[model samples]
Target: MSKKIVIIPGDGIGQEITDSAVAVLKKVSDKYNLNLEFESHPAGGTAYDLCGTPLPQTTLEAAQNADAVLFGAVGGPKWDNVEPTLRPEKAVLGLRKGLGLYANLRPIKVADALVEYSPLKEEIVKGTDVLIVRELIGGIYFGDKCESEIYEGNERAWDLENYSVPEVNRIVEFAMQAAKKRKNKVTSVDKSNVLATSRLWRRT
Candidate 1:
């Protein structure tokens, strides 16, 4: 069966990196005679500048129709002053919600051959392999965005942070399941010292 992928290159180096990655994918697809289609769409800060909305309907539709969507970076110092609702970073949250996709998993492994290149002591960097699983597209990233000029003659901006029980449980279950495939070990990290969200993470 043919595979469809939507590629969204948000801003900055995202375009360059995604372009090179897609080129390689095309090459490998040709070698294996795999039918693959890649469609690119604008997102993030650049999209807002072009169309006045971070997540355009056309872009979202393209992604929904594709088998997978590749994303590029968005948001930067240049867009720092944009309206909270229309901020470039909102594109990610919009896509995540619209696509019905959640959670992010990142794997880190220290190559045995590249051990000597480590900045840390050999002992610390030696067995540095871990899996990081995160709840995608929630919390502060999707919370209320605000910037205000208070009566004190100072500007303040803040994003809300929150986590639901279902969200926490789901992500934790996914992480533990992933761990079952490896060493049957998991080291969950959290800032339970302060934030209630972190505390929720701990409770789950």
Candidate 2:
């Protein structure tokens, strides 16, 4: 069976980037006979313009059912005045929640050729390879918040910092396993001194 890849070219330079990515994927598929298929879906500001929502129901469904998803960037000055909930960036948050994406793995490695281009000193970043595992779908992004409210005659807004035991445990366990594959060292950043949620995260 062929694997279907859903391409969500959000806005701005997303179209050009995904187009080039598809060309590369096609070449790889042909060389390996991977039987890959592609489908395009609108999202971000583009989707908001076409369907009145950054993440349309149809696009979400298609993403959930696809074998893989290739997402380009989102957001630009064009949608700066849009509502916070309906902003182009919300499409990424919606997709993360809808797809149950819980972790963002960012691998940082400095290649020999790119070491000279790095802003950091050559000796400091020459052979650096680090993986940053970030938790998603359960932080302030999904927390309850008020855009604007008057409190004590002062205009203010608040975003709740929320987390669950299961959510913390899941990401911790994933990071632990990932560490075992590398240097068996995991550094989790938390501010238990000032935040109650960080305490729970550290405990779990």
* Candidate with the greatest lDDT versus the true structure: 2
lDDT by residue (126-182, candidate 1, tens digit) is 888898887886788777767665647878877799889888887788888999998
lDDT of 2 by residue, 1-204 (tens): 799999998998998999999999999999999999999999999999999899999999999999999999899999999989999999999999999999999999888999999899999999998999999999798999999999999999999989999999999999999999999999989999999899999888
Look at candidate 1 and tell me the lDDT of residue 180.
Answer: 94
The predictions' CA RMSDs to the true structure, in order, are 2.5, 1.7
Q: Top model by TM-score, which number?
A: 2
In candidate 1, where is summed lDDT lowest over 10 consecutive residues? 142-151
Query: Which parts of model 1 have CA positions greater than 4 angstroms off?
Result: 76-80, 149-156
Clashing pairs in 2: none
The global C-alpha lDDT for each of the candidates, from Candidate 1 onward, is 0.87, 0.95
Q: What's the residue-level lDDT of 20 in candidate 1?
A: 89
Residue pairs clashing in model 1 are none
